[model samples]
Target chain A: MYRTLVGIGLICALVIVTVFEVTFPIIKVNKQRALENAIYQVLANTKSFSAYHLVGNNNLQKVTDNDTSDIYACYDANHSLIGFAIAAQGMGYQDTIALLYGYSIRSESIQGLVVLQSRETPGLGSKIESRAFLDNFNNIEIGLDAIDNERQQPLELIKNNSKTHTRQIDAITGATISSRAVVVILNRSLSFWLPIVAKQQEPIT
Target chain B: MSTKPGEIIVTGPKDTDEFIKGVWAQNPVFVQVLGMCPTLAVTNTASNALVMGLATAFVLLMSNVLVSSLRHAVPKQVRIASYVAIIATFVTAVDYIIQAVSLEVHKSLGAYVSLIVVNCLILGRAEAFASKNNLKRSIYDALGMGVGFTLALLCLGVVRELLGNGTFFNLSVLPGNFQPWVIMLLPGGAFFVLALWMLLINRLKQGGPRD
Candidate 1:
């Protein structure tokens, strides 16, 4: 009995170790490439980007330490700042929706949105990744307050085709919860980062 | 190996019988009703269903081959544990492979891919078929079962995608005015479709209509 158990254990260990060694590098490269692509995708018109951490009280701290909340400063072809891409997460219909979106400091609006990860229900909630839904973020104004404390107009999801307000997003039909979740996530993320972004100058990279 | 009383021993594989049984008589989803979780969860779209079915089939085939090859060496007492470990190793390998292929599909499949480790279909095959069979027969059994599973999933997926989204494989198949049955895209719809498939299969098995 003892010998049999040990043999099984050894076999399992060998298989696992062999597979891990073979696949780990490919998985790593794939993930890194995806991350880079997502960063560039969200912040369009970007020539390059520099990573920075958001430290205490939403300060733009240098990227000396590895943190999940690190923001990317996007630069244009002339090496001038275009915007910043920040990662955000919030509750969706079935799971937490994690995404990265670009914010244009000059226009005080979101440049674009890209879903990094979402477990939203297929055919409905998953429409959050649809071009129609994501296009709603393009140049949508997120006005900063006098004290830069709050957004002048909070993001809202209206029924599809009835969107009138600059802050309103046309929600996907039958996916109200998921559409609302995206709006809520955008609002929450903007509330935290917009103020800091508005106050800070382009960091020396 | 001595057969105990009432322990109906599986005979040496007659290639075609092993293969065809899985496709029709012993269809995992429609007939034997195994692996319901993935069958219902990922069948909302044909593409998602196809990818998921293929992934499960890959794991099933690899695990069956490994289990059959190791059957002689593994002792009866620890066989189940050994089988599970073997299945899990394959699942992890496929998981990484899918992640490398497409992050979108990987995310869509999500935890369901990992959950394949616990899928009774793969384990059931390993224990009931592979453990008692030789490698070549086990491979044939795995292939048939895998293909059967994929076909069953495709049926559900095609029906659901066509009715729920008015699209098949993401292309609009139904007329523009045709309103999609939103219910067909939800979890409740999955149960309805599977139940209907089972009912249809049962009726066919019973032959001409009977009160």
Candidate 2:
């Protein structure tokens, strides 16, 4: 009995490993293409982009795509830098919501946002991906006004489109929690990433 | 399986009956109502349903072939474990293949592709049919069942996408002025569509006058 079980296990493992090896390269290519497309979408008019990875918590280094998470510096057709595309994720209504957004240091605001991976409630909480809600992130202020290594004012969530400030994200009518969830995700992501990004401080001018 | 005249009149372990029964007589979705998790969750679009169906079928076919080939070697006590492991291997393969083929379809299917390992239909076949049958018979059975499962998902996908979104396979079929049925796109809509399909299949079965 033991021998037979071991035999089956061996065969199964062999087949799986073989399949994984055969398809690994192709899967990697597909994923890389998808990320590039998302970066382009969020950054707008980005004809190309260069990949970078942060060493430890501070030093951002340019690197080729591998297992390491990449932060993209988007460029236009003339190879001039447009902005940066950063990836972030946190808990949403249903599952982890992985997001990508473009940040313009010049404007001190986010250029655009895309829900890279979302399992929020369809038709309800899922509205975070809707154009009406995502438009909130387009050029919205994050105002890098740091005081003693902390944001002077963290991003805020408001309702009824009565936002008193630029960085304040408005909660949509139907997807209030989901909208807040995105903001919460963004806030957490920004608190960690923005400081690192601000230190690099390379203006595209 | 059925005493009827040309009405699913097919039964035998080695012949085409192994294939035919799964399509008409023993459909995993309509007749057995197995794998409701994906059947309900991802069938929101016809294209999603088609891709899912193909993935499930591939897993089923490969697992069934593996299980049947090893049936005699595996002991009764660990049979279920062996079957599950086999099914899961194929499911992983399908998941990777889908991811490589199209990222959008993979996203739409989400974790349901991984969920195929837990699907009772594949396991049930490994236990009940494949274990006792020969390799040739299992192949027919898997293909038939695969086609049947795909067709069933397509059925629900077509209706749901059409009524709910006023489209089929993302193509606009309904008139421009047609008001979409909002309920057909919700989680609740899956139950409604499934119940309707079950009703239709069973009713048709009973309505066969010459059977």
Candidate 3:
């Protein structure tokens, strides 16, 4: 039994390790490219991007990989900051929806939204990634006064095409939970990240 | 092996029943009702179901091949653990391959891809058939079961996607005014469809209570 067990263990390890080694580089490149594309997409007109990590409450330091929140700063062709792309995740109808959105400091508005990952039901909640649903993020001023660490008004979820208020976002007809999830996640992410971003506001140029 | 035509023949007349048995008689989904979790969960869309079916079949084939190849070396006492380890290696490999292939497919499959390791159908075959049979027969058995499983998933996927969303593989198939049966996309919808498929298949194979 011991010999058989050991032999099996060795074989399993060898096979798994071989497959993992061969595929790891390809998987890494795929994920890295996807994230870069998402950042560029959310922050439209972005030519290049850099990621910054929060250090000791307020200090912004450049990082390659981080477990804690790392905000990506997107720059235009002139190397001027266009906006910041922040990733946030929250529970949707079936699973957690991970998304990246661009927030413009100069205009105090959200630029765009892109779903990084979502496992919602097809033809329903998955519509969150639909172009029509995502278009809701185009140029809605959040009135962010990062100096005070607060948003002038909280984002609201309204019926599709019932956008009478500037703060109201239209939820997909059949994907209410999944649509609202984006709003709720953005709200939480903004509250947490905007303050930290404010501390080192300068030198971002 | 190269000179003999029979060596590589997939569906030779002599052993054609070996393949047909699993495709019809002992089907993993429609007849045996094995791996109900994926059958019920991922069949909401035709594309999702097709990709999932192919992925599962890939894993089944690889695991069966390995298990059959190593049958003699794996002692009876620790056979279950050995089989699980072999199965898990392939599942992880499949998961990574799928992710590398398309993040969309990876996200759609979600955790179900990882959950393939625990599938009763794969393990049951490993223990019952692959362990005892030679590689050739084992390969045939796996191919038959894999095709049967994929066909079953496609059946459920087509029915659900058509009635629930009025679309087949995300393409609109019905007129604009067709109101979809919303419940067909939910968990209850899967049970309704599976029960109906079972009733239909049972009626065709009528011979009293199924053994």
Candidate 4:
């Protein structure tokens, strides 16, 4: 009889612990959401946007129709439109890294970028998240060639360094591969978004 | 090595022997091949690897001791469930502590923190060592095993970071003129490093497990 009661008591103790365990994480879950939203606002530069609309499923804009990327679009106060920012993904040393980059049709340049996901070796290729690395895009163009094409060739980093590419940006020293991969993903993704931007820029009566 | 019916006494030097066995001799990842998921996932940085190792160690130590203390009381059919519950509680505690102290590390680790509850090494040690031994021995064994796992993660983190970025812990370790291997920062690079590391460890041990 005592053994059965002790077993019941132990089960109840476990049940209480489980209940407590399950409840607090739910509260923490909400706090986490708030923290995440605050971080997103900081990176999204929502203040610069006069008009911000959450688009697509859960307000995420699918960057590639193929669903390879997604981005949050921010418009300036004038509504002339600031830029098309999208989150892009590529393989890093140990894991996939997702990044948010803003391309401006008006400036014909990249405004900024933020690392959204990365499994790169810490203290190394993960520098993609560092402000120094990301700041490289501040004034760089999307198209690579000096010769203008009806379709702009998005900017990318080349290992050998070429002078002819208008869109070329300096790759991070010792992190050439990561730098180049980030550029390629940004360029490939911009190709898809540009047409949309061009279409959106079109006057709709 | 037989103890009570169905219980096997692990023959070793005993006492300190049980404690030191997991560090290099019976390493959970390289030597034992246990707990491969987190071993592969969170080793992108030395800091991250250290945090994960510490968190796992905390859980392993507590769970091993608790399970050992209650070994005889647990019914055979429900032993696994009981062990898991104990582990999950410790994991939740570690998660909260990490979040409170360093949100940066917490963010970097993400889901893998919670996933530690399921890591095989903790439960494996609990069942294999704790179930048959007294609490003191179990604690020692857990600590030793935890150190081994931590060392392995540190090795992976250092190799990947140095090759990929020419730096260690964000400090420039290589010359400015050196070109980093971009592949070292990619998933393919991780797999390559892991394979090479295992092979190196294997060769170092003469194609056999190290003691």
Candidate 5:
């Protein structure tokens, strides 16, 4: 009886392990495809370029594209620099909210901010993904302090005290921690990438 | 081994006490400390807690019945691993169903749906009662436990949502400009609410073994 039981147990274990191993690769492939599709959607209007090659292994890259403000640098069919995308991240209450900002090298400012992922509370912290909130970044010129490459004035949201067309965003009411987290992450990411972007750009008048 | 369903001896509390024990008494979260992940992870809002509780209850019911029926054949040494695999299969089934039906809710709940495999409530039921009792008794125990868990999650969800967002299940009850306490939605909020609940329940119980 003992020997029979052990044999059955081994068989069951082997079957389970084999099933998982067989399905693991397929699962990974599906997840990767989904992620790629999401990123492509965020980086809209990619048809203007001939290529969309990933820049580095870090998974965070500065890309240049046209008709976009946050563009860092993009290349034409002949490998010429067109625009750039500045990627930034901020800490939210539950998880880091990654933003893909498209900046135009020609325009020299942020085009728009797209929230990639945030684990914030639904109906509350999730407002960061809403257009009403993200619209705040549209066409805002990247005006960080040139001295030591730090921002002169950090971007923030003043809740219920909206000043229209200012660089500041209106913070989501009652979600100040989450709101500040996004601001801090956005500022920090932009700050980190500003120097790298400056190094890549030619001397602009 | 030959005992029929409902024929096994029940040594614990009789009648409604067994049924009511889980409410806040032998509450799975506060008293027994079972199902910690769901309680902590899903109680961000009232809606998530409700769905999570129902899902867990379904899994608990099925696992209890099956385990009780098969307790004799499950070899003693490998029972733990077998029970896990069984419970995980049911959890995976639930996950796919949820995903197929409501993509939005699935997105909100995220990986917590899969983490149900490790929920201690199902495993505890399997070990404590299912392994000893017949199928009918096991079903009753599982139902009681499920109701208990749902009630506990509901309580937590109601408090957190009302305090954090000034609403229950997204129905705004608080007046405009309530200035919600933001911490009620954070992980810290889950811990504090659970601890306070335990204290309150303890006081109510007068130091008795929670239900």
Candidate 6:
């Protein structure tokens, strides 16, 4: 009995390892493609992108090396800088909601948004991906003044169709918690990266 | 001895009976009522249901083949462990294949793919049918069960998707003014749909002429 169990264990391990070895590379490539696609999807009309890492807590510094969690600077066909795509995550209705959003340097507003991963409840909280919810981000202002430290309330989520201000997002009817979560994630992520992005916009020596 | 040492005595049902029983008479989902987890979770959309059904079928087929091939070697006492290990191997393979094939489906199905490891249908078939049958007969039985399971999921997926989202396979089926029943898209809706299907099948069976 002992010998049989040991033999079965070895065989199962061998089979699992063999399969993992064969498919690991393919899986890696697929993941890379997916990330790149998400970046391009959020930053529309982009021909290429360059990754930059963020360092420091308060005074953030951007580095070209890919050592840490990084953001992408997207360029159009003419090689002109279009925007930056940054990944952000925060607590949602059921679990963490991770996403990517395109930020326009010139306009200082979010261009688009794409949810990378989410564990929100289906049918209700999952409406975060719906066009009606995402359309609110199109050129919506995220000016530095909206940060909590400053006078303005950071990125407010209003009732559906009640978005009278540029900084306000319309919440899905039955997904109030999820909608608020998105706003909170965007606000936190934007507050941390906004200064660094502004510094990058300046002409270097 | 009365029987020759290598001579096999077939005490189970005929090969055709084994194959046909799974499709309707002993349907894994409806009759045996096995693998309810996936039956409820991934049947929200027709496409999700179809992909999940195919994935489950692949796992069931491979596990059945391997189990039947090794049935003689596995000891009676540890047979359950051996069957589980075998089923897990096939589930892992199917999960990776699905991820590589279509990330969207993989994402929608999510943890349910891994949950296939625990699905009673595959293990039940392994012990009840595959272990007692030869390789060819086991394959036939697996195919029938897989097809039956797929058909059952499709039944629920069609009704749920049509009512919940006002669409079939993501295409608009209901008129513009039609309001989708939001509850049909929730977890409760899965139970309601499956219950209705089982009731319908039961009523049909009872109403039909006696076999």
Docking class of 4: incorrect
In model 4, what lDDT does residue A37 have? 49
Considering just the first chain, candidate 5 attains a TM-score of 0.64
Worst 10 residues of 1 chain B by lDDT: B1-10
lDDT by residue (A23-57, candidate 3, tens digit) is: 88888888788888888788778898888877787
Per-residue lDDT of model 6, residues B1-211, tens digit only:
0112112423445775555666777778888899999999889988988988888888899889988988888899999998898889888888877777777778888899999999999998999989998999999789878878888888889899999888999999889888777777777999999999898788766887566
lDDT by residue (tens digit), candidate 4, B1-211: 0111111334545676675577766878778988877777777666777889889988899888888988888887778777887888788777877765666688788899999988999989988999999988888889888877887777777887788777787789899988777666655666777778778777766856656
Best by DockQ: 3
> What is the iRMSD of the candidate numbered 2?
1.6
Tell me which of candidates 2 and 4 scores higher on TM-score: 2
Per-candidate TM-scores read 0.88, 0.85, 0.89, 0.59, 0.62, 0.88
Candidate 5 achieves a global lDDT of 0.68
Model 1: residue B29 alpha-carbon error in angstroms: 1.2
Tens-digit lDDT track of model 4 for A88-146: 67776667777766666566566677776776654567677777777666666653222
Report the Cα lDDT for residue A91, model 1. Answer: 95
- DockQ, candidate no. 3: 0.55
lDDT per residue (tens digit) for residues B49-159 in model 5: 988998898888888876888788888887787677678766776776665555557777889989988898899988988889888778877877887787788778889
Docking class of 3: medium
DockQ of each: 0.47, 0.51, 0.55, 0.08, 0.09, 0.50
Error of model 5, residue A140, in angstroms:
3.1
* iRMS of candidate 6, Å: 1.9
Candidate 2 residue-wise lDDT, A125-203, digit = tens: 7778889888888887665655235645467889988987767888977677788889988887777777777777564
True contacts kept of each: 0.43, 0.54, 0.56, 0.02, 0.02, 0.37
Each model's lDDT: 0.81, 0.82, 0.82, 0.68, 0.68, 0.81
Where is model 1 more than 4 Å wrong at Cα?
Answer: A62-67, A121-123, A143-153, A157-162, B1-13, B206-211
Residue B66 displacement (Å), model 2: 2.4
Model 4: what is its DockQ? 0.08
Q: Rank the candidates by TM-score, best first.
A: 3, 6, 1, 2, 5, 4
- Say which candidate scores most in TM-score: 3
Kindly indicate the candidate among 4 and 6 with the higher lDDT. Answer: 6
lDDT of 6 at A111: 86
